[model samples]
Target: MDNVSWWAVASALAAGCLGLSVPGLLATLPLRLRPLPRLALAAPASLALIGCVGVIDGLLHLRFHWSHVLIAAAVIAAVLWPIREKRPLWSCPRLSALLPVTASAVSSVAFALVLLHQVPSFDLFSQSYDNLFHLNATQSILETGNASSLQLRTLINTDRTLSTYPAGWHTAAAMICQITGVSIGVAFNALAIAVVSVAWLPGIAWLTSLVVPQRQRTAGLCASLLLGTAFGFFPYALLIWGVLYPTFLAYALFPSGLALAMLLAHVWLPRWAPAVSDQVRPWAWNDRWMLLGLAAVWWLGAFFTHPRSLVSMVLLIVPLVLWICARAIAVAWKAGGARRRRMLWWLGGAFAFVSVAAVAAILVVFRVFHVASRPVGDHLNGPQAQAVQTVWDGLWQVLTQNALVGLGLDMTGSLIILAVVVLTGLVIALRRADLRWMVVAYALIAVLFALAAGSNSDMTKILTGLWYKDRYRLSALLPLLGVPLATLAVLRIAALTRWPRVVALGSATIVAASGWAGLWAPVGAAAAHEYRLENVKTTDFVDSRQIAFMQQVADVVPADQLLLGDPWDGSGLSWLYADRRPVFPHLNGQWDPDRLLIAQHLDQIESDPAVCTALRHLNVHYLLVSTGEFDGGDPSGNKFAAIDAAVSQGLFTPVLSDGESALLRIDQCS
Candidate 1:
């Protein structure tokens, strides 16, 4: 990596650490010493740390390109520094803060262990199609020294055409590639295993602080630890599917945005009952403005990083804007002129900032990427159609069977159940006129928006053809969001009952148990099955065979050649091999002529001499086929029979085959 790049990454990390750790250090100060201190203290410390890291990277020769790490760290520091002094740390005595930190540390360690054990299995067989695109983009940039005109179509042999997928993710990876000059494998491994998890931690901490009360701060901290570790640390660590995709990063932002929104709402609402004698306070506006600012930042990040997330935010924000408007109107109607003026200013300012930020993001993305929004359509057909059905069924099973215990990682149903539960909690809380419950409701809606936006179906049909399947259900976030709300509910219920403490303890136990069961039963089972059946050591499946065949094809094809194939087939090809771009016939409801040529009538292409001539005319170098028959009926039980006959005529050469599938190299037909 260049000196500047190294400096950027190093500085980012240093800044993040300094910003996050400073609050804990301040918590050690006496209560009297903590009142109205200079908020600038944390900011300087974080900036200084970033500067130091940059200086060290420039001066010292650190082998690994620490630039991306530094950039991410610095970003975190910049975010946390301003809020550090303003937000109250849990009012714990010196030693008390250690308990939550300890809990978080333990959970982090456990999460690391789970990830390490599962990495080998996930890397070998599971399709990391998104990572392949990143690698392809990075390679093209490295070779050509230009980001634009670096074609994705040439890398994978498919006719789906380019422009369906966004370039931002690839751009980020290419930036990393420019610095490290390492294999794509190493770069992706670093991103999936480390960068994403670290980036998520601070937001998790901030959200935990918001949801957990002052008295139960330690437990809240523990809850954050549990949420982050359980949902993010453990599950993502064990599965290749979740962490490698941009959706994971985008989904993480969902909670952060929701938390900030809730905080803003809390600040805007009248703290005291509306009465003539009620006294107004200066600090009342603090949470409102702080939250609005934070929400704007999160929205911007989500927009640039992932489009699906941006879509989800819109769905969530519309309802919230209406809610805010209603509350503002209510406050204005009842309050005096002076009070009304202040409220209007606060509401207006908050709205303006958020609106500006969101609009700027949309315009920037469109301009930089040259993305044109497309309409959504029903794309699931054939095996994919069946897969979608199974996915839906699986989701339903998750909700019904493991509502409280949760269906664990890779289960969409758990997420749905959790959403339902949160909604139910919100309804109960709202009926009882509890402010906290309303906050949770808003948070849940925001999270749902993020999830829907990041969803594979949404992305494939709308933003880009990049799909991570059902993993985007984000069951982990459910637990993270649920724990504190459930805890509070338990506490409230206990307060009203004779056996309040017992009930509270019982509820906590049930939740923890449910979490443990969810973690172990279905998610663990799926992971274990994947590990046992498809690990690098053991290869015994159709997917593996397909992957190996595609790898062989990648070896022979020129780095710049594009392969045209079926959408499902193309995804598999692009994912398994580097520098091979597959063009699917239809992506995000758009069809490309080049992709259509390859997808049309393989059976006819095999039998007709003229079709071979036409294929060669189009510069088609090879044809790949799996076991299944094409749209036309098999010439025999074997779909490749007529293709085999064509090959025997010496027009095409059989380059590679695993007995079941084959790659036929196209030669000029004489």
Candidate 2:
């Protein structure tokens, strides 16, 4: 863990890339889209495949091996093989056609390097709040041989029979680690690096092309990747703040799903505007059905990755959904008969009912997750007017092509090239009716961001709660629409220049290097956090010395025994790190009575018959004691009030110690 192992990083990166993308690519090969869009769609497709296979394997009580994923992909490819368009007879294509693929690939590599260098270490984790739970859960999948989202709840609470955490991210990480033979920590870092761009770059490229064709040039592709990757608001902000890997993966994959959904809208419902029809492929009926089916699978995949992102995706695409329905109704009314009109009204009523039902279901999920009903965390701890100011700052940031809102970074240092283009793109989108919906979508997202960042009102909670009312998430979304608009503006510039492609490359460089437009502060902060964490004596659950001591735990303690420690205190990580199970595997869980008994009276084992009985029943002979907790808040750990009494009175045999971290055996119970 000292000097980084670049070879391990490389293998983990390759395996993570293949595990996340290959299955989806094979499944989507039957689609006739050009290279960029097709490639972008592959990742989510694979997510759907992997998550479903895990769930199925869980129901049937089967172990999840890496081969199971490949077999699933083969089955899907074989099933979809019949629908292949009968056109090409193995004819060689021109080299010009490969430009988009080649350029995008190169840009992805550059972007990936920037992201890695931004992080202090490619192997060590950032240890943001949620990572401990996610990391332990990924390890649990390998240990229990049950990767079903439903089965994941046991990792948090052994007493629970049913719960879900959208294990798509975990399932994929498990497979990557298994295939590459790397630790979960290394595999996860690779995923954090590779899984992000799998959907994003091509998705944005296809979207830019679809929105504004700009004379069928590769400049859009070039500009999209370069400018798209330069912005630190999105994918980078995510990797840093919460290290919100599940949401990060879901967001990367959602753009393609959104683009496909928009395409489906165009194909199924012809618009009054000619531009909408002209931009989309003229798919056959069979193709539409097939695409719809794949889109459904992608939705499931996104849900499996993280339901909140699916919620975000659904929220962002509301304008398009409303437009499609409105267009269909208008077309129906124009050719009206009383009977047909009546039927149209009935269908509209039914659609409205279903929409209401869906909204209700979303609200239910919000309540279940304790989101949106009340302010969460530090959303608005200041005065009321500061909320308004934050909203204004957010709008200003979006307009100026600054994604980091109020992070205290100097915004004026960067040149305004990207800002000017983003505004120009906004102007262009407003003028073109087909592109107008994008502006509408952007506005809707901005309003949501305002509610999230500025207000903690009940209505605000309802709207922003699913995201835990986090401005970082809402701010990150502005680029979901803004980045494509920026790419569109660059593509327009490229169209006018004699050297269009050169303009694309040069523009990305100016914005990136021009006072470090979007790349400066995020890179500094992320690197500082990641690199600093690597050397810190303590971070959240586990400490540096504690980690080294844990490496020796398995040698002294039998593999079949369990560790007694507070998950909050970090020693509970022995379950995942040292391959020794812990009585409490997470910070919180619906613990069984026996574990609860030991937690309350473990120090009284010499005199309390109940404590000894519970310890022996659970086979908990070893105790991992530490005085620290994640976030430096509550160090209650396993809640044994007199636990440290053992150290003072020699109640237990000391097995190992490194600073405050110690391992002990309960001899009195034996």
Q: What lDDT does each candidate get?
A: 0.43, 0.71
Q: Considering every candidate listed, which one attains the maximal TM-score?
A: 2
User: What total of clashing residue pairs does each candidate reach?
Assistant: 28, 2
RMSD for all candidates, in order, please: 10.8, 4.0
- Residue 90 in candidate 1 has what lDDT? 49
Misplaced by over 4 Å in model 2 are: 30-33, 87-93, 118-120, 272-281, 326-389, 404-415, 512-517, 534-539, 635-650
Question: Mind giving the per-residue lDDT tens digits that candidate 1 earns over 72-148?
Answer: 45565565555455446545557755655565555554554444444343233223324335555455544444333
lDDT for model 2, on a 0 to 1 scale?
A: 0.71
| lDDT for each residue of candidate 2 in 136-173, tens digit (9 for 90 to 100) | 88888888888998878777676678777899888888
**Candidate 1 regions with alpha-carbon error over 4 angstroms:** 1-98, 108-120, 125-196, 199-201, 228-244, 263-294, 314-327, 336-480, 489-510, 527-542, 545-592, 601-620, 628-651
Where is the poorest 10-residue window by lDDT in model 1? 31-40
